[model samples]
Target: MILDAKQNEKPAKLTIKFNTDKGTIYLEVPCDIPDYGLQESIEKIIEAKCILDNNSNEGLNDLYIVEDKSGNLSIMTLTEYINYRKSIRQDILLLFNHD
Candidate 1:
C-alpha cells in the first residue's frame, strides 16, 4: 500500500502477470473491490485482453497473480500456491513423524 500526500490515504493494488509466446504482460488492478468482485474483474480483464490480442486463453499456461505481503512479493499461479501449501504441510508432517 502506498500512502498519498494527504494523510491516512493508503492505496492498494493487485498486480497480475502472464506470459505469452511473444512476451509477458502485466496489469495493475485496484484492490478496493470485494474479493469476489475482484476475481470477476481480473477474469474479465484477462479474457478481454487475450481476445483483443488474438490469443486463446487455453494456450496461456503461464498466467499468474502477484501478491505483496509485508513488503515481500510473491508471484505464483493458483496451482503453484496450492502445491506450495501441500509441500509445507508435508514438511510439517515429516518433522513430526514418529515410529
Candidate 2:
C-alpha cells in the first residue's frame, strides 16, 4: 500500500499554550518532529524558549506545568525535562518488553 504525498505529511505546526499570571500565552512554532522523538523535542523547545524569555536566574530554574492539546498535563523543571523524557521512554520500553 502506498500513501500519497499529502498522506505522508505530518502537521507542520505545534501549539503550546502557557497559562501565566498575565493570561494565556500561546506559542506556535514549526514542528516537523518524528513520532518517536516528539515529546523530547517539544520539551527541548520549551526549555530553550523559557530560558530565553525569563529575566532572572531563579526563573530559569522553575518548574513548568505543560498541558497538551488533549488536556493532559505534565509538571517538570526545565533542567529536568530531558531526564523526565528518558524515564518515560524507559517505562514505555519496560511495558512493551515485559513477559
Candidate 3:
C-alpha cells in the first residue's frame, strides 16, 4: 500500500544492500531523502559502516540502491551516484577522495 507521509516527512524503512568480504549486509538508511540525495545518504551510511567495521569501502563501487518509486531496487554505479549527488548539490569528490 502507498502510505504518503506529510509534507517534509520521511519514510521509516529505507534500506540498502551491499556485498561485503564475508557476506551481504543490509543497512538501514535515513528516510526523507529524495532520489537525488541518495548519493550523500549512501556515503553517510558507508562512512558509518567504515567506523563500525573499521575498514574503508574502497572497492565497494556497486550499491543496491533503493529508489523512491514503490520500493524498486537498482544497482547504481559510482558515476550514477556522483551524478545524483550533483543534482542534489552535494560534494561529488567525497565519492572518490574519502579517507
Specify the highest-TM-score model's number.
1
On residues 2-83, what C-alpha lDDT tens digit does candidate 3 reach at each position?
A: 2544344334766667665533445444566578567656665565445435535565534434343344333354566557
Candidate 1's residue-wise lDDT over 1-99, tens digit each? 677555545568776665655345454456676687566656755663564366445544443444333332243444765675577678757876953
Q: Identify the leading candidate in terms of lDDT.
A: 1
**Using Cα atoms with residue i matched to residue i, what is each candidate's TM-score against the true structure?**
0.36, 0.34, 0.30
In Å, residue 71's CA in model 2 sits off its true spot by 9.9
Error of 1 at 12 (Å): 1.6
Q: Cα RMSD to native, each candidate?
A: 12.7, 10.6, 12.9
**Model 2 stretches astray by more than 4 angstroms:** 1-55, 58-64, 67-74
Number of backbone-clashing residue pairs for each candidate, in the order shown: 0, 0, 0
| Candidate 1 steric clashes | 0
What are the lDDT figures for the candidates, one per model?
A: 0.55, 0.53, 0.51
